[model samples]
Target chain A: MTMSEAIEGRAALALLERARAVVDPPLRTALDTLPGPLRRIALYHFGWEDADGAPADGGAGKAVRPALVLAAARALGGDPLTAVPAAVAVELAHNFTLLHDDVIDRDPTRRHRPTAWTVFGVADAVIAGDALFALALRILAEDPHPASAAAAGRLSACVIELCGGQQADCAFEGRGPREVSLAECVEMAIAKTGALLGCSCALGALYAGAEPERIAALDTFGREAGLAFQLIDDLIGIWGDPARTGKPAGADLVAHKKSLPVVAALRSGTPAGAELARLYRTPLTGADVRRAADAVERAGGRDWAQLQAADRMAGAVQELSRAVPDPAAAGDLLDLAEFVTRRSR
Target chain B: MTMSEAIEGRAALALLERARAVVDPPLRTALDTLPGPLRRIALYHFGWEDADGAPADGGAGKAVRPALVLAAARALGGDPLTAVPAAVAVELAHNFTLLHDDVIDRDPTRRHRPTAWTVFGVADAVIAGDALFALALRILAEDPHPASAAAAGRLSACVIELCGGQQADCAFEGRGPREVSLAECVEMAIAKTGALLGCSCALGALYAGAEPERIAALDTFGREAGLAFQLIDDLIGIWGDPARTGKPAGADLVAHKKSLPVVAALRSGTPAGAELARLYRTPLTGADVRRAADAVERAGGRDWAQLQAADRMAGAVQELSRAVPDPAAAGDLLDLAEFVTRRSR
Candidate 1:
């Protein structure tokens, strides 16, 4: 790895470690009394148990959001440990969306096992998602420190945006491929994904006693970084290898998802748009995924998506630079931004 | 009419007046942009329209929770108008549960109309309920006041309890009829139903700047009153005339619901319990409902539930007396509690 990549990896890992150490007791204690089926399913989704609720290791995702929270706290001159509840809140909210998104997207697999919908049914999954949504807010309430309500308020506001953005995203599906402008798509992604990330950062700064203006700056930084990460995610969904993505290459193409790149390609409205239009007309199978990917690539969909992702990453870096002029306070967080935007998995 | 009946009638009318004045704007604004089908079904469910979203009147139920909020605020020497958002919050939360509950129970009708699930499909209903739920929290956020987070937190915490109670209630349905105490059933109802009611009162006090201790006491009062009200509801569901109760008499008995009266009778485990078990073993029809009602009355379920309601009403009065202290503040608020426990519809 290059020098910057090595630094980014270490920062990401270190931030995650701190978040892990701080979260278990209070969060776990909240789930201790559930019935076996709910307990097991929830635990498995939490990556703490097998699908049946038995103790086992499987399908755990990287705690990237929480890492950003902790790193942001430290960057704002606060001890990361004190911001635990806020960190946990963002992570839980992230997972809450994932649970519902899987059901909405009709994705059967997540982390290699069946999605919560496949395993628990949509009814139970919706209930479980609501449960987690409540849990996230409750976790915010548990913070006894003075900054708690502000942190909770910010998180709650961001989640409202998340729901709105998700609703818009789902609405996009039935109406045909959304020809969202590059700017508009980025803004929607900011709501869909960046709002929580930025809240995490702002929450950390609030706990660290950062001034209001600086806290707002940290929020701005996290927002851009979050958008950059989502753009990169869109690219990976379409082109990343199976080993890294945990799905067939070009899964986005197969699903005909109105991902940023696909939207970009549709907006490009060239041979690529015509090919995408044709593919969109029929049911896509495994072979069709190959053709869709090839068509998008030849039609320049893949290239546009990648270039857009890189541009977002650059924009994020510029935003971060303005937000944290003190390189000393910003170094580690900047590293995190780079790592997230560059990740293959 | 008896003196008690007149008071209840007046209170019910007052509740509707207070509810429509506060609930309409926020509910309509949030739903204005949704697709026609979604908006229509949701509006119908909220009693804002017929199933077709056309303008209508007279379908709305008594807005008991919001009335409790306004009455509590007025009783506490505060402006009832100031508590409007809290009132809306409680009502929205109630509807949120109803939408989900109908889906979980697979019930086909509510308030003599096809249920939201029947009209919109379960998926749309779920999304619509979420839309309402988010709107509840958003209303709190939009208040431009200091207590938004605290109010949201209380509502959120109560939602968690409500979900757990619902899960337990659903789980109990499959377990064969067995002895369950009136007290235990009350606890379930409180968790399942009282949380929102209690929140209504507490939120009003909070908005009015009532002392924290007073707020806690008012919450207790509202909860006890809620229990009394639920017991009364259970009575209407199983024994009252269909003309008075709106739905067919003995509806809960037909559904084999574990209402307060049913639980009380079952715990007796005497002749009533045995008769209940036999009746429960057979699928209930319209004629069967009449039979079950007779057995329920003969088994003393109606009286047991009534006596329980009397005790809870007294307890709630005692709690409110302790909190408000001033007889003047207790004026219509006491009438509200009595109305909640005595109303047939």
Candidate 2:
């Protein structure tokens, strides 16, 4: 990687962490309003405390989405702090999804720690997630901003779409590899992951009183970046380092997940594709997961996904350019978009 | 019951059915926005369709909550049709709770039919419930009225309280009956059930541009009615005819639920209370459930609950009188409150 790119990436990461720090107090305060156990579950899930209510260094997530909200506001010539509620809402909704997804996926760990469902039990975790969802909307609905209704509406719409996408993703797991097309998988990823990211950016722009055209442009930028993020995430799921990713190598393959690259490989119709499909039809584990990853890569799945993500990044930058006009003004969001695709985890 | 009161009850039931009919189309349209499988599950749950998606007499719920919404609007001299969106939101939120509660309670049946979680898998049912919740908030957020924000905020707050109440109820199930107090049980019931009823009426009044005093008065009326409704529900759970209630006879006793009456009975510290406690400590089925119900009755649980419900109904009527002033104008809402306390199922 170029030295200049590395410096830019570091700066972008710093911006993300700073923005997250700025939103933490209000986010925590908002969550504090939930009933005791539900609040504890949320606090634990957010890496703020332990299951026993002790302090812990359970790492915060990268905060890319919240950063996008703040960045979008600044790019639209508005005070980033004005969009703090939007940032908080997006972060809370993201965590809500994480808690529920952990339950739905039955994953035991997240961010190098036990998932909240494991600690609090599934029922409490599920209910807590619901509370957080309600809280996210409540914050926006009760906000004094004139744009709150639009923002809340968009956020809820995005969440419903996310649920639909998650349903589709779960459905795909029960099917044979060849049954799901690349188009369908991509659509699911866009809905499940991209919609919220886009909504995050658009909400900030909306709160900033940006023109509809600018809001739409920023939304497009965020969606494209989200797609890129998902593509890279799928790549990491298949072949990431366990030490770096905080999960077993090929964890998705072991779970027989119909991830984007896996679906792409199966849809390739090549000899490797046929082999990968046969392997996926059987339950996979241990050596088989490793073998499956090799087959996916051999079918050009890795290269195809990498190229697609790069294309998405390019598209995201194009959208950002249309919205911001001045290249210098768009630096943080653009760097963050690049950082998303470049991350190993 | 007095002949005049019985007539009023019949009229109230008729009003409930009429309100259910009025809200049906919009509610159905809202459900239609969900994806195919989720929509089908909701439709089946609502008694509009059979498991196979064919039309059936699945039977709408008594529509008591929706009726309260419309009746409150009318009592405040607002057009009932103007409050349709509020009615739709409340009903959707109510059903959303039912879906999640079925999963949390692990009950196989609801309304004498297979629960959604059993028909669909638990995960899908959960995600669908989440979608419905988001849709409920979305409906209010997108409403044209200036009161939409306030209504949405209140509804979300009530839901969080409901979650907390459910958490408490579930927690109580793990303890001996004597470990819980009547006050705690009543508080749980109020949060779990009364908060939504209050919010429904309050939303209607808010949408009608009612004064804050009237809104508060109507909220109190609905909450009092909700408490009475729950007290009667506890009674029915213990002794109602299975054929009419669509549940097994003495279901609550069989499950050892620390319901309001059971808590009251246990807290009485009488010989019958001791026997009821002993029976609850052990698992019960068949004749044991009937014996448990008998013990609860002998402990004065039945009489106590009946009197409490009557008192609550009186309080509800008083509140309604204060809000509406003219007794005739408040008649429909008063009848609905009375009907809630007098229901057989």
Candidate 3:
């Protein structure tokens, strides 16, 4: 909202746009290798084509992960052009999770359109997701970069952690609100969201031929930033405007999603937290959704989430400084990180 | 059945047992890297543990794919022991497919026990399968062999093809019996069943440092043998004894599975084919299953599948000979190929 924040936002947008410009061609080429039926589904999922196989201009996403890959590489003194494959691979891997998660979650829409599973059926969507993941690894395998194998290893391991995180998220949905702890919820957030972001940065550092310690520092930086992003997103999920988030207010509350703040509230042990748990015990109606949101706020969930986001961003900046000592060199990475945590939608 | 056949069968069994001995330890080690929840599902899926997490001796399926990997390496004059990672990776990839296919097809059982999806629920099974796939690639990426990168590329591409084949198979389920062409069915079989078998051999050949042409030949060898195996398995699905197959007779017919033989029969353009189509249109009762089996036979589906299996075996031998000219050197590969096609279950 301030002048410097506005400048950082624009700078982050420009970086993301540049990443998509370099990453899209190779990403499309990799996807074109898929057989016809699978290709169609993947193209549709990426917003490049319609369900009827027509071309569409629907945006894929903000390309935040890819931007991080390029920015980290540049920050570490690598050619961003040479790391394009890493960027493409990271984007592909991120979208793979989106397709499968949409199916598992059974929510209808994504990227302001019907989810792939809704348009093409669950079986096709699942298979398309599998193919996307394979294509991601294939890109790394085929890359002639000296760091390709190591990047592949990190990416593959990150995917496993991502799956574990998703499995835990689903498992949490079946239990009572008070059954999940704040620590467990944070772990899930790191695994589900932070792992890939960390992987993206680590891959960039790998391509940059940085030292192992530097790579580890960049990974930590991205992970902390990713956690901050998730915290803000969770807050938005509860209080975000429908016009911006494209969902009803308190959508997570209505679905009884055990998001970070909701779990934090339930574990707070305040009277308001107990009231929120009672509301969560049944299917939430219109009035109950509002009541639950109020209880979460009154129990200090909102304040806790805001403070945690700021703390995580601070940790992220500290780690970034360790990896890239010069503030000027770290400017783009810092801009992108701040942009993600500041997003309202 | 005959003196030479009996010897070959026992030799193949011994080879499989040896493969399991070498491959299981590393496979278990790789799987052990999974988080506790995911490891439990994978262990149960592999028949290493009960659904309740107790260690059980429920045998994992015969290590046929791993045996082929080692046999292919040895056939090409490489030290099979050094190819253990390839063997472990191939087995992991094979099990990954098994887990996903069971979920997609909603099959209730595998290896004579309840399927993982049925026991752990669909979400956990899906996540477990994804983790297994990631672990498979991680093994290849971490291998220090000169050929590990090339092998990873081939394996990743093969996984994409496998997904394509599975997608085609699911699509066929919604069409009429007469609508799916025999050629389409055969292509699907090759993609679904033969592709991974070929990949397993190709990966071994890569690890062996074989020439590209030799690797291609070995891949073809495995694929042809795999097709023959599928054809024989399809025949058994309709006609094999219940005691041997662990299923009722005509199980595929009961489920209206448009397997290779059934598709061939439906496209035969004979009165018996028409009768079979009618039987397929409605749910088959006990007597109807018998009639459908008779119709497929009269339509020449049984003879066609048998002759095709033999022809495929011959093609497999030709390809194997191209890769491994000496009969003595090719013996193990031949034994495993024959064992698979000769299986009744």
Candidate 4:
């Protein structure tokens, strides 16, 4: 990329990050309302504190979803303050999924630290996740905006779809390679990853009193961006450096996870695909994790995922164009999308 | 009780049951919107179907919470239809807790059948519970009533409290007997059981456009009834017949569950209390279960719990009188409370 373009992208991304930072105090205050030790677990999970309830120099998440909320609000010419609760609600809902997802996946680590379940046991972790889900809805419902009810309804519907997607992903793991399809994997990814991102933008539009068509366009853009994000994430799971990813190299491959790339490779029907399938049939050790990553690439999975992500990003920009009409107004959203894909590169 | 009083009590109790039966169609329709296999698990859990999705001649729950919604609405002199969504939402929320509770408690059976987690596995059950939680909020958010937002907000807050209470209960289990107190146990019970019931009544009152003070009174009534119901339930968990309770005799004793009666006995400072505490220090066997139950009774645990339940029931009646004012309007709720305690007798 050219130097000017890189600087513009960073500026746009920084703007979104700054907008997300606006949601932190309200989000923390909302979570603090939870009675008893659950507040401690929530605070610790959000990287605000250590296990002992002491403050730590912890990092928050990427805050991409909250940024989408604010950017979409700005794109629609609405007061960003009206969308603040929506942003916080989306972030809370996102973290709720993360907490439960870690438990469901039996993941021991997140964001370079031990998972909440590992720190506080499974039952409390799950309960804390549920509490956060309720708090997210409560935050939206308590907002004084006229659109609060509709926003709460849409966000919850999105959550329902998200859970359904997670269930589908879990079910896929128990199935044979032949029983799985790329289409199914993509659908699950859309529900599991795309739904919340789409909801974030749609909620922002809703808060802005944007026209339904505009909201739909923004939702489409966010959903496509989310798909691109997931495609890149799957690639990172197999090949990205652990230092950058904050996960062990080839973590998904080692678990024989049915990620988009893995499903794509297994369906490639090449000799390498067949070999990869055989390896997946049984458990793998440390050595096999590296071999499996190479096998996926050899089966053309890496190239296909990368191409799909680019295509999805293009589609996202198309939807953004439809929503914004003016290219200049759409510039920041486009830059944010560019930055997302740029991370994988 | 006199025959006339028994007859009057049965008739009033019948009114609430009839109202609950009215909510079934709407409740089932709401659940049907859940995606694919989740709907199946939910249907099976509610005892509406067999594991294979075939219709079963099964019984639904007592629907006590739903009854409170309708009865509370009636007492406020409003159309019960206005509160139907609230009733459905509360019932859904109650079942959401049941699904997750079974998983957390690792109980194999519920409502005379295998629990959802046992039938569908843990992950799906947890996800299914989450879906119900979302669906509950969705139902309220979609309601046309102006009070929908407030009802949704209150219900979500109650759910947050319920999670905190469950967290405390779980935490207590890991601690020594001396670490737990009656006050703490009571507070947990209020949160875990009372909060939802109180929210049910409050939602109904909110739907009726009742004044805040009136809503608070109704909430207090429901909360106290919930406490009484829990006390009786704890007693049944220990001493009730297995055939009648659909559980093993002295099931809590066998598990050394720190139930209200058990905690009370352990705190009694009597010789029987010490013996019971000693027995609880080790896992119980076939004969030990009966001895434990006897020791709890000898420590005045049984009498204490029974008296506490009556006291709470009286307090519930006092609150009900404040809300209803007219004795006739309070009849159904009073009867429901009577029936709850009668089950233990």
For model 2 chain A, the run of ten residues with the poorest summed lDDT: A55-64
- Cα interface RMSD of each candidate: 3.5, 0.8, 0.6, 0.6
> Per-residue lDDT tens digits of candidate 2, residues B4-38?
98799889989898898899999999989987777
Instruction: Give lDDT tens digits, candidate 4, residues A76-141.
Output: 888878799999999999999999999999988888789999999999999999999999999988
Model 4, residue B6: displacement in angstroms?
Answer: 3.8
Sort the predicted structures by TM-score, highest score first.
Answer: 3, 2, 4, 1
Model 4 C-alpha lDDT per residue in residues B157-230, reported as the tens digit of each score: 99999999999989999987646888899989989988898888888889889999889988998888889889
DockQ of each: 0.36, 0.79, 0.86, 0.84
Candidate 3, residues A1-345, lDDT tens digits: the string is: 999999999999999999988899999999999989999998998899998999998598999999999999999999988999999999999998999899899979998899999998988888899899999999999999999999999999999999999999999988988999999999999999999999999999999999999999999998999999999999999999989988898998998989899999999999999999999999998899999999999999999999999999999999999999999999999999999889888
What's model 2's lDDT at B231? 94
After TM-score superposition, the amount by which residue B253's alpha carbon in candidate 4 deviates from its true location, in angstroms, is 2.3
- Name the runs in model 1 displaced over 4 angstroms: A1-3, A32-41, A50-60, A114-121, A142-144, A177-188, A211-213, B22-61, B107-124, B138-149, B179-184
Q: Residues B12-117, candidate 3, lDDT per residue (tens digit)?
A: 9999999999999999999999988999999999888999999998589899999999999998989998899988988888888898889898989898899999
DockQ for model 1? 0.36
Candidate 4: clashing pairs of residues: none
* Collision count for each candidate, in order: 0, 0, 0, 0
Question: Candidate 1 at residue A257, lDDT?
Answer: 81
Per-residue lDDT of model 2, residues A210-284, tens digit only: 999999999889889989999999999988889988889898888778888998999998899999989987888
Candidate 1 lDDT over A1-345, as tens digits, reads: 888778778877776665666665655676554434555556767777865667866345666777777777888778988888877777777777887778777888787777877876766676776677777776666557677777766776676677666756765666665445656566678888888778887888888888898788778877877887887888788878899777788887777787877777777768867787788778888788877777767777678767766776667666666666788888878877777777776
* Highest-DockQ candidate: 3
In order, candidate lDDTs are: 0.75, 0.88, 0.93, 0.88
